[model samples]
Target: MDTVMKERDLAGKQREAESINFADLSPTSGFFFTSPFRSLSTEGCLTNVSEPAVDGDVINGKFQQAMQAAFSDARAAGIKHPVLCGAIPFDKRQPSALFVPKKTHWIERSAVMAAVQAQESELPAVLSKTELPEQQQFMQMVTDAVKAMNDGKLEKAVLSRLLEIKTRGAVERPALLNRIIDQNPNGYHFHVPLEQGALIGASPELLLRKNGNQFYSNPLAGSARRESCPQQDAEVSRVLLDSGKDLYEHQIVTEGMRQVLADRSRHLHIPATPELLSTPTLWHLSTPIDGDVLDPQENALSLACLLHPTPALCGSPTRIARDLIEQLEPFDRGLFGGIVGWCDDRGNGEWVVTIRCGTVNGDHVRLFAGAGIVPDSSPESEWRETGVKLNTMLRAFGLN
Candidate 1:
């Protein structure tokens, strides 16, 4: 863990880290995590810590124990705050984590210029999916959700659908990640190696980022497709802002965040209204919530666990919406709607909702998207929204 690279070796190591396909660590034991928006990226792994707590309050205790272990390892290696990255599953009990000791060097964009200039390669010509739900089925499910909302069963339930894309050959993950980063320069771009494959995307929402005691969470709920024309896009944003349904959905998320963060933080700040946040394919109603963590020991991941399935991803009345999701959504969400990013031992890190992402396994990749269902939600419109959401990952595959 304390290995040092010579000057020449350092250059070579940096080059390897930048390579689109260069992953020094095994998916089963190690990982590569990055944030292109911050121009910070890291490869290789020094240690992998499993969250031991089964559930409830015990979980954070286990997480804290793991953090102590990682920090101890980092301290021995001369690192102050080692980075830990993994998918915090919607189901918290699942074992999912990758911790890299501070011994590893973090490469910045400036140091990886050669990797960026590397030639782009073509994805396999033929691609297929094991299964895709029929359009009618998804629409009907949405209809049922809307009915449930009107029936007072729940205020909102986010319904998600998965689309599997496969190629004849293994996917060039780094290439695909690079493409997404190129298109979505401002988005939170990430690539996390997994046992089965890897999770990659340009997420538009930030779940939590803790810098010492200060924390920030920007949640997005309401959305509209971004039009190609500037005037048309502005009109669309205006319409989204004016729409009662979208505003209501947006409010649910902001209020939910307030309720969750209020008890844990000394002072929490949330905007009176949501601002328009645009990705390459869609514009969303976004709210930025900032807080001062009362407990200095709480890291980014800890805050993320507290607000993992926000109303933006799940629904109002968290428990009720989660139950409904189980009844409605056919496939397991796995890491979708979960949290992903890096946390450090010094109670600092960034975690973002695992949205606009896909799981890549060999030649196959499964993409996911969800729409918030309110009483007035339109099945057709929700269906279209999922499609627009899928386009973020699809574009990386060179598809429309």
Candidate 2:
């Protein structure tokens, strides 16, 4: 049996070697995954599979089964430690996962190494595909959310708006991805190709990162736009830390995460206070939570699935917030407010909240941003917060 296994592995490697055709592959046809502050980037796809989450399981048991099959195929192709990438919907159902084996090529660079790099060297000016939401409409949404909070219907709700941008021609996706990497080197930069479109972003919030039994999560909630002046920026951070309403809002997320993770964690460490984290465009109240999993079998994706759509994205009392989002928001949110990253068969992976992200399909791109609406939240201020968030991606397109 041992000899037979060795022979099979040798044959698989031979087949993989013969199948290499770097000249013909499109960037969208392959898989990619990278970690924040890491030099290594995984590329190419050895096998891929996806399925709808039709049952109680959030990760989609069917998808998990399909992943196992893909893993088997990958190993038969002489690949080990296959990695999966893609996004989960705001709704748990209809999640997608792509399994790329360890045999996938690794590139060490400030940018992803791919065929798309050869297509274009120039960046195009961004054009709006849809008008921004009218102030009255957005204000009304904020007012309604505040009313809901006052009426005890919900403690908090995250309301979002979409900004659709287009280009004269297909925006060179690889170029855009590289720009995001260059601009936000400290962020969780990702470029995941989907069946219909691709999800790209630089996320500052880490949903989950698992290494064996150890896990880490950094949830960012209350936010303030960064100021150009150093003094003003420091003042903004100070104000955010002192704001009673913002602190309450931040606590809702931190406490919620503690409750959910505590059961799975043997020794969970949650700070009594949230620290400030900054991106190029905004400053956020962030709490970093770490833990040791009670069960070693519990992997990254499973933990991410358990904590996704946190109060940071949905709101406090998740069920109520989700219902409000469906009724209040005009868009479906597809992959926005979801989680994206990759997990190996061993369950180690890094999944970041799909914030500060845009979906690209050819020349069209849709960007998304949301703000937590508490009782004291201002409609105008919430709208501006989203605008600040959108700037992170817009700047990558050369739009100020």
* Best-performing candidate as measured by lDDT: 2
Candidate 2 residues 196-262, lDDT tens each?
6788888988888787787888899899999999999999999999999899999999999988888
- Expressed as tens digits, the lDDT of each residue in 41-100 for candidate 1 is 554667776673234222357766776777788778776557776677765666665566
Query: Model-by-model lDDT, in order?
Result: 0.74, 0.75
List residue ranges in candidate 2 displaced over 4 A. Answer: 1-29, 37-47, 53-63, 106-121
TM-score each candidate: 0.86, 0.86
- Residue 183 in model 1: shift from native, Å? 1.5
Alpha-carbon RMSD, candidate 2 = 7.8
Output the worst ten-in-a-row residue range by lDDT, candidate 2.
14-23
RMSD of each: 6.8, 7.8
